[model samples]
Target: MSALPDSRYVSLTTFRRSGVAVPTPVWAAPDGGDLVVWTRADSGKVKRLRHTSRVTVAPCDVRGNLQGEAVEAQARLLPPGEWQPALAALARRYGWQWRITYGAGRLVGILRRRERRALIRISPA
Candidate 1:
């Protein structure tokens, strides 16, 4: 499904156990028939996805202001070994900016001893 927008940022809405929706702005890129997102492994969105794959996404600004209609989708946290394509997609979309951000994040991850980066695959539901 061609649900993903061409915008640089997307607001990913993940649900809580109580069914309240929590939205967070994230960078996303079209990957084949799905969209790939780069995020923190331990982020609340990822945690929520673990319990429920249901989510909604919409084109947004960097500050999370929605610029388009939301589309229902399912999300999955990709395995660590499968992160390369996701990283590549983001890098292609963001260019040098992604490189800088990824580098900084990796350094922080190392210093903090955390598995800082994770990939999320989103498909139209």
Candidate 2:
């Protein structure tokens, strides 16, 4: 239904400060004309994105096994005003699995005292 990684998992490659590529598998969903992915605000990807918006994404399996070639894209961390709806869109796409995973994360967050979540918006480069 959307051009943004329709696969169950996508490998998002973000560059480090030294230009090294770091790849991570994540769940992605469509938000308006952008593709959004959720992650903790303190994540390495967030840190890397601060320095450079250039990224690449490819359909992959849950284990990060590539299923297709990657596509170049520009990524930005969305501001607070839109993260909630982006998460809702993710729930719609992933359904119960999303709830389960998010719930588990919430519990972990409670134990770890974390509430900083972020939504990353990606568009064609």
Best by TM-score: 1
Give lDDT tens digits, candidate 1, residues 16-120: 999999999999988887889988888899889989999999999999999999999999989989888888998999999999999999999999988888899
lDDT of 1: 0.91
Model 2 lDDT per residue over 1-125, tens place: 22556677899999998999999999998777777898888999999999999999999998999999888889999898877988898998899998998888779878989676778998877
Worst 10 residues of 2 by lDDT: 1-10
For model 1, the stretches where C-alpha displacement exceeds 4 angstroms are none
Clashing residue pairs found in predicted model 1: none
Q: Give the RMSD in angstroms, all C-alphas superposed, for model 1.
A: 1.2
TM-score of 1: 0.94
Task: List the candidate 2 regions with Cα displacement exceeding 4 Å.
Answer: 1-3, 107-114
Q: lDDT scores for all predictions?
A: 0.91, 0.87
